[model samples]
Target: MLYYEDLTTGRRFQTASHTLSEDEIIAFASQFDPQPFHTDPQAAKTSVFDGLAASGWHTSSLTMRLITASELKDVANGLIGMGIRDMRWPRPTRAGDTLRAEVEVLGQKPSTSQPGFGVVQLRWTTLNQHDDIAMQLETSIWVARRPVTTTEPA
Candidate 1:
């Protein structure tokens, strides 16, 4: 597993793509966020989005899934999230839109209270097939840190 130090600023990782279907969007929204724009494709035409759209939470969940299936999961040890900030869905995610994620390391700092771990700041940007941003968020994750080693004069 990669330690916290391995995650440096400007480091980026891309996740595999997952296509969202109309049926899937409806199903997910119906359970969590049952809004017309998300659950009813017909009614969505009249909604602000002008057509069917996936719930922002659904898009976030899908992004998390993609991350877990990528190298970030291995390095960060399954995305031990501490908290999130500035989560925004700039554009709607429509059915048939293939989604992928690009995760970048913004910064990292050793945990002051916990010596064996550290916190890494990451920016997660989910994009559609057309490269429109579906969702973006900054989150803090806990990553195991390699112990510092020092040598004494032999």
Candidate 2:
């Protein structure tokens, strides 16, 4: 499992791609966002997107899934979020778009209150197959520090 010491500034990684289908977008939006542009293809054609689009929340959720299920899966415990910052959806995520993520470790700092834990600042840039940035966010995650192990006297 990766610990706080395993991450450093400028460290980068990527996640596997996931293709978003029309059905998936509609289903996700219908349950959570419930907007015509997200739930109805025909109605979306007249909306600002001019086509069916996934909600920003859906894009964020998918990005989180990719991150947790891919490179960061080995993190100790899990990617426990402290908070999110500067989240933006630059472009609408269209149906049939294959999405991938670029992750970068911005910084890390030991927690003052928690001796064995630290906070990692990370940036997640979500992109579509066409290389368009669909969503981006900066977040801080709590990560465990490497445990100290003492060897017995031989």
Candidate 3:
């Protein structure tokens, strides 16, 4: 299990490969994004993308899935995602493109007000099979830590 002590300024982890499928992309976009480039291939051909592509939200969600499957669950100390910063979708993620996620610990500080918890900042980068970065962001999360305990005199 991951504790606050395990988190260091340079700690990092990489996720396994995950390929995007046309059906899955369309299904996800149809319900949430519903954009022409994301849901319909023919329409996307005429659009700026020139082909079907995954929605930004869908890409983020897929990144989360890759994280979960990477066995980070044991180390995640009740992560409370504060929010994302400097988010950018640099390249279009088309169907059939395999993706992976890499997370690096940027900083961490024990919560002054809340005991047994620390705030951690991390930078996540998702890259496609061609090694091109598809999405990137920085996020903060609250992680549980081992609290100091005082022993009573025998």
Which model scores highest in lDDT?
2
Give the candidate order by descending TM-score.
2, 1, 3
Backbone clashes in candidate 1 total: 0
Error of 3 at 37 (Å): 0.6
Point out the higher-scoring one by lDDT: 1 or 2.
2
Error of 1 at 13 (Å): 0.6
Tens digit per residue, CA lDDT, model 1, 15-59: 999999999999999999999999988899999999999999999
lDDT for 89 in candidate 1 is: 99
lDDT of 3 by residue, 64-104 (tens): 88887775667646556888999999989999999999999
In the range 1-154, model 2's lDDT, one tens digit per residue, is 8999998899998999999999999999999999999999999999999999999999999999999888799989699998999999999999899999999999999999988999999999999998999999999999999999999999
Candidate 2, residue 136: Cα displacement in angstroms equals: 0.2
Using lDDT as the measure, name the better of candidate 1 and candidate 3: 1
Q: How close is candidate 3 to the true structure, as a TM-score?
A: 0.92
The whole-model lDDT of each prediction reads 0.93, 0.95, 0.89
Q: Clashing pairs in model 1?
A: none
